[model samples]
Target: MAGKFIVIEGLEGAGKTTAINTVARVLNQHQICDLQFTREPGGTPIAEALRNIIKNGLDNEPLTNKAELLMLYAARIQLVENVIKPALKIGKWVIGDRHDLSTQAYQGGGRELDRIFIETLQTQVLGNFKPDLTLYLDISPELGLKRARSRGQLDRIEQQSLAFFERIRQRYLELAERDNTIVTIDAAKSIAEVTAQIETTLNAWLTN
Candidate 1:
């Protein structure tokens, strides 16, 4: 049997990192399956290097929307080829913090980039391997961004304006609406509540 694939998605401060780590531990405790928690932009060596560049903005110039989209795709392709597929083939549960939908949100909505172009790239490059489950942490930009800022020194991508984050949040909701595999959760709740929500969802999935 093919491995189960799970995706955890949300805005900058939707508590994705904490949830992923928590979920990984939960998965292990239940012995549901072998679980791996990883993130986008870099799950491999070369892709990680690319990730640093994208997040840090060492280029120190505004990245065009198209370039931003393509850069994300480039890293995603590397991730799929290098890590995700191989693990899934061996029956490992792969929990991606963010995946292609993120590119669609950040580049497509946040940056007002070309949608058709991105759809074409996704269709052509990432075929058939869809997530078994996608957990959407639904939260507004105002609430999410405030939490994000408190985390630490913001990265270049995180430095984007409130309007940009709003667009991305809207896009995430749009994706959840369109995709049946996604489970949207109320993210404005406390960390423990949000974590509990995620746990409940995963538990339900495992029972099915």
Candidate 2:
């Protein structure tokens, strides 16, 4: 049986990682099925190295909007071929911390890169692979940055101005609206509340 694919998406510091972890734990407790949680950019060795470059920095001009999109898909292809595909071929429920939605949010939304180009690259490079469901954690960039700051120093992308993040969040909302598979969630609530909401939604979704 093909396993379910669940992806979590949001601006930096939106608590997507925690949500994905919690969802996996809940599934395990119920013995629902094989559950696995992972992140992109560094899912595979080659990709992880590229991930470091993206997250850290390049000595030259910061990655251009188009270059950023290309690097992302480069890492994505690696993630899918080496990590995600093999796991899904079996019965493992794949819970990803982020996916193509980031392309829409970060590259398309944040950088104002070419939308047609991004979509075309996705179709050509990624092929038919896509998440079964995406959980979009909706939160203001300010609150999200506050949380992120509490954790540690900001990375390259995180260090970008609030205006950039705001654009990214808006793009996320747009993608969620256009795609039925994407479920937008108000992440302003407490972690427990958000987890409860997700569980309730998933339970309903799985039954039908």
Candidate 3:
């Protein structure tokens, strides 16, 4: 059987790192050890360069919303074609930190970009490529940002207004509602509870 692509997604400080660790542990428990880890907009050298520009502006040049969206696609395609696709072809399970869903949420919803345009870009760049399973750690923007601030200085996107992240979360929930492959977990819970939820959800999906 071909390897599966699993992605973890959420707003900043939504505990995605911890969730990813849990997923790896569960997969290992099932004796599925061959794994390829990736992060977007990164994984490939080109994608990493794009990620830096996306996270931090260059030469104080103002990055427009449209330009930002296009950059994201460029990075995504690089990672997908160069890293993710090859890994899956070789039967290595790929665990991704984020994927196209972030664009749908951030650009389409938060940036208030045209949904039709974003969808068209998705088709052109990614086609049918997507994760087999996406775990969305749902948390309010206030709480999430508060946690994010505790870690260190906020990045460019992270420094956006609370309203921006709220839009992103709303989009995430809306998308997750209609997508059976997406599992939403309440991230406000304790670490132990969150881990249990992820384990339960992933185990059930694996068994099915």
Q: Which candidate wins on lDDT?
A: 3
Model 2 is weakest, by summed lDDT over 10 consecutive residues, at: 28-37
Q: Which stretches of candidate 3 lie over 4 Å from their true place?
A: none
Per-residue accuracy of model 2 over 1-208 as CA lDDT, tens digit each: 8788899999887888778877787677668657766787778888888888888877765676677678889999988888788888987889998899888788888888888988899999888889998989999999999999999998888999999999999999988999999888889899989898888767766766
Please say which candidate is ahead in TM-score: 1 or 2: 2
Measured on C-alpha atoms, candidate 3 has an lDDT of: 0.95
TM-score (all chains, Cα) for each model:
0.94, 0.95, 0.99
Between candidates 2 and 3, name the one with more favorable TM-score.
Answer: 3
Of 1 and 2, the candidate ranking higher by lDDT: 2
Q: How far is 90's C-alpha from truth in model 1 (Å)?
A: 1.0
Off by over 4 Å in 1: 59-62
lDDT of 3 by residue, 1-208 (tens): 7899999999999999999999999999999999999998888888899999999999999999999999999999988888889889988999999999999999998999999999999999988988999999999999999999999999999999999999999999999999999999999999999999999999999999
Clashing pairs in 2: none
lDDT of each: 0.84, 0.85, 0.95
Candidate 2 local lDDT, residue 13: 79
